[model samples]
Target: MASTRPRDGASDKGAARSADALLARMTRASAGRTAGILLCAAGAAAVSVALPAVLGRTLDLLLQGHPDAGRALAAAVALTIAEVVLNAAVALLAGTVGARSTAWLRLRGLGRLAAAAPHGVSRFSPGDAATRLSTHATEAGAAPAGAARIVAAVLAPTGALVALFVIDLWTGLAFVLGLPVLGLLLRSFARHSSDSVSRYQRVQSVMATRLTDALGGARAIAAAGTVDEERARILRPLEELGAEGRRMWSVQGSAMARSGVLMPLLITAVLAVGGLALADGRISVGDLLAVSRYASLAAGLGSVAGPLGALVHGRAAARRVDALLAVPPLAHGQRGLPPGGPGTLELRGVGVSRDGEWALRGVDLHVPGGRTVAVVGRSGSGKSTLGAVAGRLTDPDEGEVLLDGVPLGTVAADVLRTEVGYAFERPSLQGATVEEAIAAGAETAPRERVRSAARAAGADDFVRVLPQGYATPLEEVPLSGGELQRLGLARAFAHAGRLMILDDATSSLDTATERQVDRALAREIRPGTRVVIAHRLSTAARADAVVWLDGGRLRAVRGHAELWQDPDYRAVFGHADASGGGGNR
Candidate 1:
């Protein structure tokens, strides 16, 4: 089910605001590099604008047989070299800033994903999130440096236009006459290109999402003999993606084509006007040469569209990246758990809804300190939801949950994490090594404590037999489903506090191992409240009390033997034996 989270409705204004804010933060993070890029770009522009005029004067000096011609020629060559060096510096600084910004953005994105409630982050599929963090971040990170270049990009043309007027007013005026056409071409391209770029990105995101989903379910696809169909489905968006890509190219081509024809005509007109000025004795040969160069520089205004297009792409990508980072994080407060308090977990009128359907509603229950409570229900009967609430992994949409006397929402983030631990059906070991994975979440899980937790989960024996024992690299070790669950259980045990939630965490272990782990929970683990989301009847039987959920509400809180009398409760295990227990391994 798609969980409804606290993200904004993805309104255009909201997304733009978030994108701008995120870009601003990136700009600040790369401030030094951005400043350097701007400095280099400005220097390059100055040299570019000055070099043409100097070269024109050198030509005039040579034509007039002036003694200073050699010195003027040397000066022109020096300016040319300086321009190349400054442009190279600009490129270097831009590259560094872009790399730095991409790293910063990725870290921020990952941090937000980690800090948010799992369900909140779940809104982004693995593929979509991966695309946003990797490709989209790279695009956006290049924007600030790109923007700095735009300043110099614009300055070059404007300065050239001013130099043209100083050389000959008629030539400058002739070039100015065609400026409106150039402006229109760029505007049209920007509008069309921005729209096409945005559509292209959406298509890419869809394909990536489908491909990721297929990879995750590759085994299912293979078993069903539908690998071919899956492949086709994953590439279904290819047509639209190609169409958008072509549209972007067409926009760019049309703009460049128009500019291509218009620039030459404007330059020709400037040259003709300069010739007439030379005929009228209004300017020297040096001034005419300078005017012609200035006219070409100013006429090349069409090239601005290229950088503008990049900025547009960057902004669009920023919106997508910010969408993930903008998910409202689970808010934490300043309160901490009182020292030496037992974890008495209570849910009062707690209700959680998914996709507009209630997963749990008005399901109030309480577990005393140091007691084991098994939450038992049929599939989709809110058992896991209850576990999530008990550990505060997710907050109920309505009402409140409290541990001891403190409200969960009011607890400090670190305090809440330290006091609550969770083990899920599919545990993702966090660290590189086996022992590190087991100790990942604990505030302080020393080597001895890690080994103890592993022993309690029945994982120590198997772990020690592996190639490197506890130090074995997680990826290099082969683990069965049951072993995975044991490691997950060990991780929870290592970090277990006043409240530990095993949410269908032991479903993969055999009955004997499961029983041993259960015994260890009571004997070898911490003395605190344990909320076990159980599917096996034996698990409920071992708990101090059982919380039975019917539909979305709590049906009863009674002993397993007492609740077994109800045929419905027995049928929840998919068996008719009221006296017989159920198990799955």
Candidate 2:
């Protein structure tokens, strides 16, 4: 159920705000570097202007056989060298600023993503998120540097215009006349290319998302013999991406062609005007050469097209990064749980909705401390939703969840996490080694404790046989589904929170192993509340109590032995009786 449609207007506005915030952050981070870059560029422009003027004076002195010709030549050479050095400094500083900014943006984006809610993070596919972090981050990072170049580019033309006027009134006027045409061309390109670039980037993200989805499910697609269909589906966005790219290029090409034609004509007109002035003895040949160079330099401002294009692309990319950052995180209060309380859990009038449909509604349940409760339901009956709310993985839209008499939302994040542990159906083990993964959240957990937990979860024997035992790298050890599930259970056991929630965490285990693990949980683990989302009837049969849900409403909460007497309850598992004992074995 990933969203394939483009974002709506309100989301776009939020993204714009995020983009602005990011730009502000970049500006703050690199203020000193930005200042240095602008200073160097200004110095380079000043030197560039002085060079042509000095060269013109040298020419005049040589033509007249003046005694100061050598001095003028020396001044010209010094100005040329100064310009080169200043330009080089600008490039070096701008590059450094860009690199630092890119690093900062990527780190910030990742931090924001980590803090965002699970549902919010799910909006982006893995590949799309990677592109935003890598490619889009780099592009957005170049904004500060590109902005500096743009300023310098504008300054060059302005300085050239001033120098031209200083040389001769008629030549300056000739250059000024073409300004409106160049401005119009740039304005049009900027307007057209911004939309084109934004669309192109969106299409790129979509294509990446589709590709990542295909790769992750490659085995399934191949087994189903639908490889061709999957490939076509993944590549479907390429056609739109190409069209957007072509539109951008066409806008740029048109601007360049127009500027190309207009610039030479303007330069030729200025040169013709200078010639007329020279023939009338109003200006020297050196003056004519100086004015011509100034006019060309000013006309070269049209080449700002490249940097302007970068600015546009970077702005669009920043918006994409900002959209992810804009996802509001779950709010947690500043209250800490009271000390020395039993791990009692309660849900009062709890309700949850997804896509405008109720996943759970008006649900009221309570589990006393030291009791094990099983949540039983058929498909789409809110079993997982209840587990998630119990662990505060998500909060209900209505009512509240309480642990030990305090609302879950009121508990501080650290206290809540350390007190309530969860294991999912498909666990993500994220660490370098097996031991590290087990001890991930509880970093201070002792090695002995980890081993004990592994044994309790029926994982220690297999782990001991690995190449490096608990130290074996996760990638180097290829584990089956059941093994992975056992490791996940071991991780939860190692943490040993006051309240443990296993949301179908034992589904992959065989009957004997699961029963052994269950027995170990009862005998070895600390006494606390345990909420298990059970898919099999046998699992429910073992629990002290069962919370039966039907169509998002709590149908009953009673002992498993008592509930089994109801034919409707047995029918949920498509069974006549609980005599078979082994469910999904």
Candidate 3:
């Protein structure tokens, strides 16, 4: 249902604005490094412009047999060294700022995804989310430094042009004549580069998404003998991805090639005009050399293309990253339940919609504390959705769920988590070792209690026999489906709160083992309010009562023996009640 949450209304303009704000925040977070980059770049540009002017003065002084020639020449050398040092500093600072910003973005983006809840996060695929968090975040992180570099790239050429004007107006005007063409070339490259990079990155995500889906279902794919088909499906976007990549390089290459030819030609024209000025005694020999060098520096506008392209890619990636940020999380309130209250749960008019269809509607139910209720239904009958709602894994769209007379939404997060426990049909084992996996996320899961939980879930024996017993690394232990389920159950059991909802959590266990687990849960484990989303009639039979669901509605709540008297309820377990029932009459 979280996967079907419809993206919570993200518009293009809104996401872009959010992306802009995120980039701005990153820039602000690294303000010191960013300012250092700007200072170094500005200092480097100042040295670049100053070097040629200083060298020209040195040349004039040496030719005139001036005694100050040695000092002038030394000044030029000093400016040259300063330029290199400052440029190096800029590079170092840029890398540091970029790295810090990337880490910050990843943390915030990851936190946002975590707070969104499992159901809400299903909107993004594993691959898509990974790419957004990893690749796109890295690209977006460079935006702050990229912007600073761009200012420096522009400032250098602009300063050179002004210096040229100071040396000779005619030479400066000659260089200015080609500015329009340079602008056009850069504009075209930027527009084309932005389009191609966006397409390329999007296709990369598509392939990654397909690849992740296939990897998750690898066993099934092999069992179905469709490995080749899946390979083809996953790689289907590679061709388009390649095309976009080539187009990006083509745009960049074409612009660079054009600039390569145009820049030298403009420099030649400026030099020729400066030569004429020299012949007319309008400028000296040193002035002509400075004019030529300044013309080349002014024409360095072409070099801006590289950094500008990076900026475009980063901005596009920011949009992708900010889209993840735009997903609103499941908000919780600050209210806590009353002390020592039994975990009675109630749902009133609860409705959950998924992809324009109601998965659960008008479901009003209640369960007293410390009792087990089996929720039985057809596959799509909202049993799991109800479990999620009961524990607030997801909030209902139209109604409220209450625990101990307090709205679940209003419960403080820590109190809510400590009070409700859940085990999933396919739980992801967390942590590095068997013990840690069972006690994952708990602040203080004593080792003995962890062992007790594992024993109750029937995982203790296997864990103790492992190469290192409970200390065995999870990677070193190959677990079957049922074993994995037991570990998940143990995790839940270790933290049995006032309310525990098992959403088909025992589905993978063998009959004997599952029966043993159920018995242990009732006797060996601490008791709690239990809501079991059951697909097996045996599980329902063992519960105090059954909550039957049919087509998104609650049909009846009765003891399993009583519900079995209804033909429709029998059909839910793939039976007919042929002898003594007429649809619960």
Candidate 4:
């Protein structure tokens, strides 16, 4: 089952708000850059407006048969030079701001995700998360700056209107008639383009998800001889994605065709009207020419339809980007670990649920400073949940978990994270070298500490056999599942947290190796709290106390020997038979 909720029908107001907030932050973040951008946009608009008027004046001078037509033409040439300079400046600013804004938003989005991810979010796929943070942010951030170009495109029409009114009010009114039509055309394109672009985004997301799944399952599919089936499954979404792309291009192509025809048609109608007015002597020959020039300027309004198309694409991308940024950051609770004690972990009537199904219920457990507690249970019996709760990898749905008599939420995130160490059943190697993996995210851990931990976990021998030994990269050395698990344990050791929770950390080791690792851990358990969640009953048997969980509930808490005599515990360890009680290794 999927782990995250679908965001459908959710209030997008929050997303818009976040986008605004991000922009405000970015504007403040890059104030110097923004000032440069605004100045360039204003310059571009100024030139864009001046160019059409200069052309109108030059045409009017020529029509009036003025001997100073050469001067008017020279003025037109100067206006052209100014237009080029301004346009170039605007383009430079747009590109610079677009790139910078994309970077800012992408970084901001990642920060939000990191802050929000600590909360139990099972459905967040790594592949999808990458898409949301990178590509989506890039597209969204382009919208505001790209709007500058659209602003210039609209300026053409304003300049045209001013020139037309200068020619005659009737001619200007006639030209303005086409404005509504152009708007309707743009509105239609925006609607369809936005819809198609959104669909394309969904299709791309699916293809990405399928690709990640196929790659992750490549080993399984090859072993099962179903490579062809998996290939077909992955290809299916890609094909759909291709089809959607073609559909979007077709819609854009159609919009382009209409724009091409509409602009020239409007121009032709204006010229014919101007020609008639000229014959009737209601407007001067120069006035007619200026009106024609203005009509031509108005025709440039169609140019915005293209940028408007870009705006729609950008807006669609922005909405997706904003959605990621809008996820309320995991409510940051109190700072520092709870007061009144130190390094004593407590689960005061804690429970955890996922999708309304209880994973752990009404369980209260504690590991005081300098003590060890072993949690034993069958698969799906909540042992791991108990460990996760203590480590704060997963928070409790009810009640509270405390470190040193203080609620876990009362502690700062970094403090809680650093103080609690977790070794998972199938741990991930997050670093390149074995040493680096062992050190985890810490800035400093002595080589001796890492090697010592590896030796205690029975991993040093294999690590030494690799080329370059501890310096050998994790990818270069083919470490097996058991080896990785041990390295993961060594990482926890290197971290040396106040409280350590090993959730089935040694499950992959052989009986002898498990016993060796357990003994080493037992020797080192003093002065640091340890909570081991293991399936093997033998491991729990040696603990100071045993916690046996069943059906998401803590069923028994007693010494290993005492629990061995109980029917429920006997059944759990397969010791119900008269032949033998559950043996401890």
Tell me, what's the RMSD of every candidate? 2.4, 2.4, 2.6, 3.5
In Å, residue 496's CA in model 2 sits off its true spot by 1.8
Best-fitting candidate, measured by lDDT? Answer: 3
Q: How much is the lDDT of residue 533 in candidate 4? A: 86
Q: Write the per-residue lDDT of candidate 1 for residues 50-132, one digit (tens) a residue.
A: 98789888988899999999999999989889989988998898889889989999998999888787778877788888888
Backbone N/Cα/C clashes per model: 0, 0, 1, 4
TM-score of each: 0.95, 0.94, 0.96, 0.87
Instruction: Judging by TM-score, tell me the better candidate of 1 and 2.
Output: 1
Instruction: Please give the RMSD of candidate 2 to the true structure.
Output: 2.4
Which clashing pairs does model 4 show?
A: 3-123, 4-123, 336-412, 338-406
572 in model 1: Cα distance from truth in Å? 1.3
Name model 3 segments beyond 4 Å from true: 1-9, 577-585
For residues 1-585, what per-residue lDDT tens digits would candidate 2 score against the true structure? 132443423476766677867877886799899899999999988887777788888899999999999999999888888888999999999899889988988888888787776656766777778878888888888888888899998887789889888877888899899889899999999899989988998888888787877777778888999989888887888899899999999999999899999999999989998899899898888988888888888887888888898888888888988776776777788787767667899999999988789999999998998799999988999999999899888889999999999999999888888889998889999889999889888445679888999999999999999989999999898999899999999999888778999999999999999999899889998768999999887889899899999999999999877787777788887876655333432
Better of 3 and 4 by lDDT: 3
Q: Is candidate 1 or candidate 3 better by TM-score?
A: 3
lDDT of 3 at 421: 90
Candidates ranked by TM-score: 3, 1, 2, 4
Per-residue lDDT tens digits for candidate 4, residues 137-171, read: 67766766656667777776787777677766666
Worst 10 residues of 2 by lDDT: 1-10
Q: Judging by TM-score against the true structure, name the best candidate.
A: 3
lDDT of 3 by residue, 296-343 (tens): 888889899988988888888998888788778889999999888778
